[model samples]
Target chain A: PSASAEAEARAHQTQLTKPAGSLGRLESLAVAFAGFQGCVKPTLERIVIRVFAADHGIAAQGTSAYPQEVTAQMLANFCHGGAAVSVLAGLLDADFRAVNLGCVGKVAPHKNLIDNTIASATADFSSAPAMTAERLSAALNAGFAQAQQGDLFIGGEMGIGNTTSAAALLAALFHLAPEAITGKGTGIDEATLARKTQLIGKALKLHRDQLTNPAAILQRLGGFEIAALVGAYIGSAQQGVPVLVDGFISTAAAAIAVALQPTLAPWLLYAHLSNESGHKLALNKLNAQPILALDMRLGEGSGAALAAGVVRQALALHNTMATFADAGVSHAD
Target chain B: PSASAEAEARAHQTQLTKPAGSLGRLESLAVAFAGFQGCVKPTLERIVIRVFAADHGIAAQGTSAYPQEVTAQMLANFCHGGAAVSVLAGLLDADFRAVNLGCVGKVAPHKNLIDNTIASATADFSSAPAMTAERLSAALNAGFAQAQQGDLFIGGEMGIGNTTSAAALLAALFHLAPEAITGKGTGIDEATLARKTQLIGKALKLHRDQLTNPAAILQRLGGFEIAALVGAYIGSAQQGVPVLVDGFISTAAAAIAVALQPTLAPWLLYAHLSNESGHKLALNKLNAQPILALDMRLGEGSGAALAAGVVRQALALHNTMATFADAGVSHAD
Candidate 1:
């Protein structure tokens, strides 16, 4: 945990003008950054946001409000710098890229779109496993290779009906009811939400016996983008880079990643608590308190991008604020 | 509210890439800004932070951890750009000014220091009223005159024993116990906290008969800085400029301001939920949900400075992002 650096940062925090621990989460965030960077003063200059896009076969069950083809189209929008995440990336001046792991339709090639298609689409998990073991390994490797050296890494997802897959996976892993972990994705109506829950329940029942390990669960009930996010999280931790986990889908992937490697928890920082119904449960499971609670459900690392600004502010405050001695301000009695 | 502008902003929100109500507080902030600016696309280009500094006579009763002299010393540090809020103002590129409403010690003249001293210090409210009616009017006038042509206004306070005054004022206004509203100020120990509580209880009992009016409450129990902050909040609303209310002590002032003008609620935006105990109750009384919950107890408008960045980002996204039709992205079914 870089105890020396953390100790140095804590001492520095105390020396600042404000009372000790008054900065709250910001203080803890600075200390965490110090431990991660292995230095007394941490900087958040370079940030990289990787979005993994894929199509979920569960869309055929009328689970999502949007069509499956919207996944590929949104990738085009992201490359054209017209999406919400694209604008946020520009606002934050962070590097952004989209990886097309799988899409139901033909995705037109773009300069920033990395072609790492494991399959056109996963099989409907309600009837069968989502992907084969080989496909899962390739997706994980592709995600692992996407990690680059940066001050912070953000892994997000773009997939139609992926929330159903995430809910199925979460329900199976936690041995909870589908209704307890399912929510309307992309603003689905009440009936669609019920059907989505039923679909997740069916998927969980179909693969309950086979979902013994993380990889097996990914193969049985996870989307390609979800699996890629898990790999990216683990890979970033292995490289000693802190990753900001985005909303519901990304947090589900984080759940899987942490289950695979419990030590990765320290390397993860949750960005925001989404308004999606199941996100609260997922965040509770991870024991995470997010930086923002903007109710942002758009999952292209947008929340992470906004949270990057908060982290930058934390670093700026930690590094720049004058000490009480330097400012000649009186200390507490 | 500007109905036309609010409608335009709401319609623009739906046309954006994210789902309806997904951006949550951000969307509401944008709409609020739009209504305030009387335009569809509002901006936060100019921000002015007004910090009111004073010394409380209640410090004689050992209510604060720091000496009353620290208020003047911190004012010097603020002018030299060494304080936390000073650094944050520099970071946010906002105009910063410190108004010495009242201070116990000699404060040197500085270019950025606004000398609006109503008195040398407020009287100890545990025994008597804090200020005369004439002094209260002068303090309010000084604060009301501080408002200028800025897109956003922030009211912060710097006083050693101001929390005690705030607690006493709150207890008198709400008819609650002093223990329900008292908290540790500047990192006080348990003994000091209890002493502060008892002092507040004494002040409330002393002012119980004369606390019928808001101005009466301020005159009896509020510090000079607190009264000025309340004036600034009302003045900002009267000027049609949005005010970002800071942490605990500032919130107490806000409560008094809101009580004076219920219509001013629409013009106020809460910045953060502070670590101070009474802050939550005050926020609940105002029916306000702060933008950030950073546990920051530093009350020199620091939280408001950080929240300005969020307001800026919201404006950026509100003004720049492409609509669904512009991006050729499919809409939800």
Candidate 2:
């Protein structure tokens, strides 16, 4: 991000016919784009959206409302343009793809589906580490390879029991109570929610010594898609592209990414606060202010895709609006 | 709004790809549009954006940050495609127009400018009624004439001291303390806010007898542009077009319109919560939940124009996204 370009954009906002700061956060959003693009006026003509799908072995404990096969099913749904993120990405004219990071069920080949399977599924974390260190590296490299240069990058996750993995990882990383971060992903019953919480608590106890750092925590409790998301975040930042982090699971990936590389913090922008119970807590840990809060918990990068429109509009306004001198408008008294 | 269509839309939502209610407020938004358009799936292809610009007599009391002449200047800006709403409307491909309800300064004619001048300006409301009953009727009729059949209707306002008028109207209508509703308009200083508050309190007392009804209250305290907005809101509802209400001043118009005809409430959807202090309180009075909260205080229907994009996306997803059965995806267990 260019500080000089940001300063120029901030000064330019004051001359855009409206009263200073009247456009509120939008004014800042435009300036942020200007900084990211290293120009006084930035355009968001290219948006790249990637959704990584895998299966969580924790689902073997009946942790999720849906069966693990749904992960592979949704990846097909994503490629066939039936998933929420697929619909939104099409609307946005974004470069959209689904990365198959090892789902339990078979996924058919499609133009939008990337075959990057690291394993059939992670090991159950309640008793064993979710993945070996080598598998974690494979998943991270798979995600890192997916990142390409674009105006904006959005990483989405699709896995049946990924939220359970996210909860356990976040609890261990942030030193939080498992109950504080556990939530009903894909809508679970009260008893299931209790069981899910207890499972995460037990996993935290199991991986206590190994949870010394972000990478160790992810390798112990994270799903392939989560690690891939973490890789994508770092990769996007490394490529000088801004990332719009999605809901709970995506945010968990972001926390891990930012924890590993603190400088990656400024390159990330939060998309929305979800209905997930611990999204706010996770976001607060990163001091993130999400752009939208519509109670959406469906994570296929849908939230980020919706916010892409807003970012586009903000840039459009910044680049197209006439200055006070150009519009012949009176300045404030 | 059609109850049957809304029911059908809700049912249709549950059958789509994602989990039930995973889309959050967007699901409800699509359902509402379905009800408004009387279809199971609604599409927003035509958007009409009208910005009413006038001068407030209250500006003479030194309540605003900008000169009264800036209203006419912004009217010109709106037509010339330079203002915030103008930029947004262009981006949304909306049919945009600026109606001159009465400005202190002369406004040049343009293809998109409507000459609906009710008077040079409203009378100084601190000393007398803002408009005569006849002039209020004229302003209302002008706004009513602007309402046309479109997929969506958005009403915007531009008056130098309109926030003072809005605060006064809301305080009197809701019977709240002057301090509770008064806010800094167009970025006024601390002293000006206090003065604005005191002046509104005084006007409420002076017009106590005449403020018995919505029409009377509007005639006594509202700007011409505000009256037109009220008329437009009612007119849009009558034409079976849903109205997306803009910021503080626009919400005041909605309140008056809803007060005159309670049925008009369902026809109106709030665009965004403004930086203005009284907006939330005003929205609460009508049970309105705005779609965006970017802290925008620039009222030219800018917020509504920005939200038009969101509404369009919502409808597009509703009308076009493939259903679960269509994609052969499994439902939750």
Q: All candidates' TM-scores? A: 0.98, 0.99
DockQ of each: 0.72, 0.80
lDDT at residue A163 of model 2 (Cα atoms): 92
Q: Which residue pairs clash within candidate 1?
A: none
lDDT of 1 by residue, B73-174 (tens): 888888888777887888788989999997988789999899998788988888988999998998888898898888999888899988888888788777
Query: A183-260, model 1: which lDDT tens digit per residue?
Result: 977889999898989888877777878988877888999989999998899898998899999998898899899999
How many clashes in each structure? 0, 0
Q: Model 1's CAPRI class?
A: medium
* Top-TM-score structure, candidate number: 2
lDDT leader: 2
- What are the clashing pairs of model 2? none
